[model samples]
Target chain A: MTATSFHFGEGDRTLYGVYHAPSVRRRRPLAVLLLNPFGEEAIRSYRVQKIIAERLAALGAAVLRFDYYGAGDSAGECVETSIDGMQTDILTAHEELIDLSNIRRVAWCGLGLAVPVALSAFSSANVNLAKFLGWDPVISGSEYIDDLTASHAKYLADALDMPERRIRRELSMQLTEVMGFGVSESLISDVVDLELNGSDLDVCDDVALIGRKSSGAFRKLHGQLTSTASSVSIEFDESVTWNSHQALNSIIVPNDSIAAIVRALADGDE
Target chain B: MNERIVQFGDDGRLSGVWNTQRKNSNRPTILLTNAGIIHRIGAHRLNVKLARRLADIGFDSLRFDLSGLGESAPAAGALGYERQSAQDISAAADFLEENGRSDSVIGIGMCSGADNFQRAALADHRLSGLVLLDPHAFPALGAAIENMINRYLDPYRWARKFSELKLNAKTLSLRTVRSKSEFSEYGGDTDEQGRLRPPKAEFGNELRTLTKRGVEIGIFYTAYVQREITRATQFFQTFSDYQLEGKVTVNVNPRVTHTYTTLQSQNMLLTEIETWLKQRFTD
Candidate 1:
């Protein structure tokens, strides 16, 4: 396998990343782009992403993993890494993959919000994404904010000897004062507007894999997507567990799973 | 094996160990919080490795238990999310500060300890950084399942009985909620089919507060199923805007679960965190 570092220009800031190419130098059929999660989870899961790139290379597919402008070994600050910047990063990486690897077809695997960014980016760029894999696509950003709030409320109520409703109300007002951006308003409106049925994307023959152990609510959302999008394939893989005991903490993705993905991408060649 | 009781509130005493490399070394402190049902010993091996690693980088570390689990005093009623654990963390921070080890406090926690870091960072301004191993953003599978069973078996009678039990529990001690109706209303309930779910509309309001408080947050997420990481990243990005200076960074380990224990995986994680902390703290 060949691993090399490169940089791409995005206006003033230069986005940095590493490309993993298969050892066998035959022309590749597809290029795989890796999108990571945010915050502490990202720190813990760094190696697994590298392993994925290497495994994909062994399978004869070109793989690429890059840091957003503000994260990893890249330039910029955390505050400057916005949703728009991340989307742009994905688009830039996609172009680099095509140009460097000379691969006409591409597949995207996004860890978290990367999926949405990829979906949104590919659609906007008019890139003919041959395959897509989203690991628990966030249907609504606002709802996720709600989940964070509920967790805090639950803890406060249990700890402070206060009523849960009272804590919830107090926490809400306090959060509003703190967030200043009116996250509650944004979250509420976003949740109401979110549609995960792939209605926002033009890509056909896309597959969404939802972990059975993450949340039943997410599984239900996948079901909704399957029904709404004709070309979208939804599969519930039992190996993926987010919060449950079945979730293996040692490494998020197992070798078998990586092999399975490699097989799937290779099988697509036929 | 080396354990000492560090008292926090009147009745709360945390069982933990303080590993000091040497005198006058000015080492940064690492505070570890244990996972649910797992005692301090369960985390000992991992904590030891972490402590040694941190010490090598010029830092001291402490691993402790919250109020209920391990050797700490048990809560009178349901511990739930261990919200009080934040207080315990504050007390730990105070201990570190008193010993001159609080200048750069980096908290490394699992599950509830991870949650406590989020809460503690809000209260304690002394913390320089936090590392959450495999935190669950939502309730655990067992809790959700129990909630589902309670709702499915009997709605009215169960609610009534729960309320009565809660009232007694609250009256007898410094319990949070006094009645079942109040508890269900606050905790949320399952439908007839028994699926424990969160009311996103209401919960979003609370997260807005946590994010706005400017706590540096990092996540090591293992996406088992498809789109798990995507959903999590979206949540963080949306909320990160409220973070202190808008600093939020995440790395997804593709096939690895929440914890990085494998020799190869752990080394990669350590190197990344070391690099991140060095840059973040120095800058």
Candidate 2:
């Protein structure tokens, strides 16, 4: 695969992305956009996401994995990241991919927290995508925020060998940071209000939810998506946890989940 | 400032982002690599922050991944990881020089990348300076004694020690063996403790040669994790006979982790690096 890394968008809104062109040309080209989770989750899942992009590109699908503004190598700080801004970034990335590849048959593969980002973008924009893949998707933004905050507290407790209760108390006094990245009040306010229903998956013609565990939320969303979407599938293969203190500073390339995602995205790529 | 993607290496496979001043400057280009397998963005996107900040000061930087990591393609040849890393660092320097940028390069690395940077500096004279973060350190008796005393004095350490007592026999044995090894590169020469390292005398000789060649070195150690070096002075103490004080700068920060996970740690590290670069490189 031939990979090209560059900054897209304009001025302070510029975003960074790596576009991987397929090794071999196909009659009908397919494009996949990989959306990342915020903050430390993005860092932890960077390798796995890269691996997925490489694999998907190898299968004759052009892949574009990008950092939203205020995240990754993008033009803003983590504290400046907002859910609304991320939604706009996705739309901008989609336009760039389509304009570059001239392939409108594009699919989005949202990993971890990005699932909600993708859903929000689809609802706010006129994005009638070919397929949507949510791997270890976050169904509730509030839960994700709480989980990350707890992970941050636990990480500090473990690293400093402090009492967990004491760490929790200190963290509660100031909930401005999560796992080392600063959070903006506006971003927090927007994310906390986000709770995705099965209707959120209505933006795509086809949808696939792949995760390590099965939950009532997943079951209900799957059933709901099955009726509204032309085709929908769900798979579970435990390998890695997306957000946890134990997984911090550890590289996890989930081979099983990657394979399932590849199969889902490349289903009709013949 | 301008940032653009660069692919320069064998078969045009190595990937990097070049952050440059809008107008050219005479400052030496900074070369950054992956901290272990964390990719070119560094832990907490520290590389991006550092590169942009350095650009504000008119210094150019290239934050790239070693082959087979991040966006860079894997090497097809049979060269080992360390040898391949050295070659990759040289290639980054070459990219700068060939593009009319300054030939002098300063490498900033942490953990495994620091080890790779030091090795690369030894082989490539183009590297004029190095910022080694949490780099290698041979065990020193004084540092151990100091660390033990500090640990005992900290009331929090008492709680940790009690918890550590609950560790399984296997985990305790593993720690004992690791404690003996001190430090070594991965998949390299090994001994009973672990990877084999040249005797301290030989390592000191290499440092002397680099200093004689006018390579300005900045060595930093962090105690956020269970590191081999517990104190800042331990690095100089490890090679006290070499007389490296005037030629190199050494700092040990107990507040920062190897990865610089917290915003406070990142700020402290970036500030130290900028201050070091200005002091050592200013014409």
Candidate 3:
């Protein structure tokens, strides 16, 4: 596999990405645009996405893994990048991949916050997405924020030798102060408000939802998806851990889960 | 709720239940690991609660008995806690995969059960994640005993006794054997005049080995749990550099005890699991 660097202008800002394609030219059925999680999760899940791209290529698929305006080797600061900018980055990447690979159809895979962001953006932008694979999409920004607050509180309590209750109160205040427009809140709230219960997202012929077994939230989200989407393929792999500490650090891929995704994508084409 | 006799290890088969529920979509398969010495029936209510809650959210979960505990086949040896339980976890995952119910697998274990899951997870990449409730560090047994003694014994007096003994003997070695005569000399197990005893083994080395492996770890602790939260924290911090870039999380449920008796505490754990799964497995 060989990688090439490229930049595109969305509005006044620039988005960067590293494109990976097979050296030998072969007819490819679909091109994939990769969307990643935000903050620390993005950093942790980078290697996994790289592996996924390589595997997809080996399966006769072309993939482009790129960063939003403020992420990775991309230009701009994280604080400057909003949900809208991230969506614009996805759209730009999708267009560039089509032009570069000469492929008409595209598949999207979004992890964590990116899933909801991508879903919300896809609906609004009217992008012709052939299929979407959400690893574990957050349905509620408020719940996610609460989790973050709880996690931060625990971390602070351990570090500062303060009571967890005190830490929780302070963290809540800090998070409340940080909420604003052009922030992640809009993206988060949009996901939370999304009516995931039916087939609305089954806009494409093939849609796959993957999640860790221990996550109740993803299961809930999946329930909503199953209720709405017809011909939507959902597979739960007990081997995959999403929100846990081990997933961030390990190279393990939950082979069964990946295989199921490959099967679903392949079956969709048939 | 369904019961089936499943074979474990080479020649052991035990009766176990398979609880199934239909949700909105196909949710991931969860294998619940029970605590040591706890039978499947003993854990049945709690497991049912957890499974029902997960199903309500869109997941399908199964809680099973480890071999030699509950209804499963008896352990072949005394070290049943580790080997048999690990095998049971592997078997459970295989069962789900074979039944076409799981595309990914997650293991949630309590106490020694958690340790077994950790070992099984290391051996099987099919397991995507692990949730450990009140995991005990091998060294914690000794530490707990020491702490209990320290709470009752006068430290200054013990120190003085040690110093005097060292001065009297050229080389002082306080090794107390548990022979019958020695027990009598120390006034028996319930002693009126007995010396403090040292632990059989130091657990730090074993713990270090476990942390060195690239496995995702989440631990829930209570006041009575063998290992202190500080030890788990230190393990993660010291080995953060060696950890698989993003796959380690250590959490403590302050509202819950080792057993997770309260609904609120259980909810906290469920919430953490949900959030973590969304982040790890979702797009």
Candidate 4:
């Protein structure tokens, strides 16, 4: 399989990610356009996205993984990016993926914060979506932001090897940064107001919402979405959150989850 | 800095961000690669700062991914991953030239990236310069002793060192904790991906070739690499066969971690790199 990288959009914005083209010939050319998490979570889950994309491509699907606008290799700065803009980017990526691969059918999948964007895109998608896969999707922005803050606090406390009070004091006194990404009040407000369940999301033929047992919010969101959609399936995996400090670096290939999703796609094909 | 996404290479598989000034000059385009798994934004947006700084001084820069690393696709065969990385660097340079961005190109990167581009610069005359960050080197005996004294002498550093030396107590190796964990250039148990650096003999030969070809080189080392190379002058002594008198600039810093995680460390690094560019390439 060969992974290609390129940019396409208004004025050709600079975005970074790999396009994993299947080496083996497929009966039908099905493309997968992956969406990444927002901010530091985006950095954490990058390896996971690539690994998932590679696995999907090996299953005879063309996968294109990219950084959203104002993030990573994209043309602008991180603070410049928004949830709405990211949703548009997803739509744009979907169109670009189809054109690039020359494949009519495509799937939209994302991890963490990417789930909200994927949901928004799927709901408003002009073209029919083959599948919408969410791997430990974020159900509420309020919860997500809190998690971000807590994570940042923990990271800072651990990084400086200081007490929680000292870390809190430092954050309050100084412009607190999460990892390398500087967090802004407006950005936090925007994210907090977002709720995945509140969004107008449409269900496709195959909707596989997979998460770990420990992922309460995602699992609950998955159950609710699947129950209401009249179409969806359930799958379980090792509940390790790559967004945390422990599991970010190591590449834990979701072999079983990949097989499950592949099976579902194959079933959809039949 | 004005930025553009450039897709140039075999089948347009390679992607890069070309940061240039609106008003052009006779400056070279700097090509940057991922320091291991870290993307074009760099470990802590180091590449972004460096690129913008170069543009401020009328020079353009391109930060990109090597094949199978970061955003770029993997090579068909994993056996020649290092060879492919060299080719990727050359292709990025070719893209800049073909687009009329710049005829001269300088390759800059950290750790594995530094080693890979160093190899490329040794072979490709098109790359007129190299800014290597934390490329591996042997530590000299004298410098090792001096470093030990410096570490023991400083109270803050001394405390940190002594804290880690507590055998029974749970202690994190600063090497494994701060800069590494996630962004460690070389990770995992297996050598399946292959080594980023060339053998010692080949590296010496390449350094000689680079000097002979008149490529200006800037080699920067952080605390970790300082531990590896020991002395700043050891680079000269080890590569003494090559006429490195005016050809190479070496700075070994023990103040920063490998990835320059802190704002202060990152600022220091940018200052060092920008100063080097001004002296070597910028007119």
Best by lDDT: 2
Ranking by TM-score: 2, 4, 3, 1
Candidate 1 accuracy as TM-score:
0.43
Give the C-alpha interface root-mean-square deviation per candidate.
Answer: 17.3, 2.2, 20.6, 4.3
Query: What DockQ was computed for model 3?
Result: 0.01
The worst-scoring run of ten residues by lDDT in candidate 3 chain A lies at A174-183
Model 2, span B1-283: residue lDDT tens:
2788889999888999898874555678999989878789887788988998887767889999999888888999989999999999999999888888888999999878887898899999999999988666677777678778877898877877776776745666775567456533432322222334456776677778889899999988766423356665667787889978689887877655557767888888888999999887776
- The complex in candidate 4 yields a DockQ of 0.15
lDDT of 4 by residue, B15-126 (tens): 6787867466457888888886666667756787778777777778888877766656566656486688888888898887777766788888888788788878766778
Write the number of the candidate with greater TM-score, choosing between 2 and 3.
Answer: 2
Tens-digit lDDT track of model 4 for A42-77: 766777777777667776888888878777766666
The CA lDDT of each predicted structure is 0.56, 0.79, 0.57, 0.70
Give the alpha carbon lDDT tens digit for every residue of B1-283 in model 1.
1223244443435556566665434545777766544544232134545555665665566766677554456555564544577777777777777766646577877655666685677667766577765544333344345446645775554555577796766554532233333447656543211223245433344334554554455666543211223334544543444442345565555444234422345557667767765665532
lDDT of 3 by residue, B21-97 (tens): 54422445767755655444222134545554565556666666676443355566675555666666777777776
lDDT of 2 at A216: 67
Predicted candidate 1 versus true structure: per-residue lDDT over A21-57, tens digit per residue = 7658644687888887543234334555766677777
- Window of ten residues with lowest summed lDDT in model 2 chain B: B186-195
A94-158: candidate 3 lDDT, tens digit per residue: 88888877887889988777777787678777678777887766656667666655764654443
True contacts kept of 4: 0.09
DockQ values, each candidate: 0.01, 0.55, 0.01, 0.15
